[model samples]
Target: MPPTSPSRCRSDGVHLVLPIVERSSKEPSAHEPWYCIIFSHRLTSSPVESIQSTFSPLSGLINGIFFTVIQINTDVRSAAALLDQFYEKRRILIVSTPDISNQYYKLQNIMVQRAGCGLDLRQVTVIELLGLPPREVGRIKENRLSSEVIEELRQAMRISQAYFTMVLVDKQGMDRERYIDPVTSDELFSYIDTYMLSTEERERMENNRDHCD
Candidate 1:
């Protein structure tokens, strides 16, 4: 029909195409394609990466920094929530196994790793969660948890001395990630840099954005 329809598609099939235009994300008539230049500076070593294990003050952001180290034979959920009420800083709860009666080799391992020294001590809270059916030492958040909770969590976490199990949580008192049998200080520090520092930076960015907003 009509030379095989030399026109654009339409309901009536009678519209002819006239003009078309194109656009790009570049300057018009530019001789060279646009390029991105990144200005960078020589990265200086931070206090935490000292050559002789110097004291680090949590990257010198110690004004509002805090840390808690807990060692216990309680349920994970109950103990975690219970230990968190001690302070308003970053908290680390090391769930102990049933045989965590007297031998504290596990805790010793952590201290030897530069985790509970210098500025880390100021930010960390060390508590021993010994005895079966972990119990709260004192009233926290105005209420003490039941023994059932501690028992349930103990079975779930299955913390023991034979093998190692560690958790790396965020500053907001949330479970970010967990570790088991970390062999070296680098592995431990790697997660701290990745999760801890990043979380702190993200929080700082959000606060700045809110202030600007």
Candidate 2:
């Protein structure tokens, strides 16, 4: 079964519509969340380099989790464009060094794939980083960013030629979590899904309270 649209869809757009079965049949529905997982720089071009999306099929636990992990090759301008679009919208970003071989990035690859993982991708944009030479960035390369934005990120994230890091940017586009060299996969996973997710929710709850007050 594919997504059905009540109205016409654009040729260039992606439309996936599924019935909300768990929700009440009498009540109106809202939009489903979309998750974007960015790959900051050149991939190793190895099969193992990918974030494995496979999950256990036990008891249809996956559908309860409704997020998709989209790996965008750097292509800096497009990435910059995407960031601009998402920053004001519902998105969370995960930034990491270019080395996908790093333990942290791989953990995110797993975290992004889980159902009921407790993070909403539609409201979050994930950013991963690389250590590429500025001269290597070009229109043709998929893993590149605007020079100005790159400089901004380099300064904000304290990127260097020496360390592998992962920086988590919250919905406000503020840096939430930063992990540098020698961080283990267990530590990385906990930092992101546990602490970060809880902090994000806590802020959201606070905002909702503020709004109602």
Most lDDT-accurate candidate: 2
**Residue 44 alpha-carbon offset, candidate 1, angstroms:** 22
lDDT of 1 by residue, 53-127 (tens): 322212221122222122222223465554444324444444333334434436545643454332132222333
Model 1, global lDDT = 0.33
TM-score of each: 0.36, 0.40
What would the per-residue lDDT of candidate 2 be over residues 1-213, giving only the tens digit for each residue?
A: 111322211111111212222333343222232223221122233212122232221111122332233323333443354455455433444444455565755665565444112233223434445446654232211233556666556665465644556565664566666656444444544565455555645554343322211
| Model 2 worst lDDT window (10 residues) | 8-17
Worst 10 residues of 1 by lDDT: 11-20
Q: After superposition, how far is residue 203 of candidate 2 from its true place, in Å?
A: 13
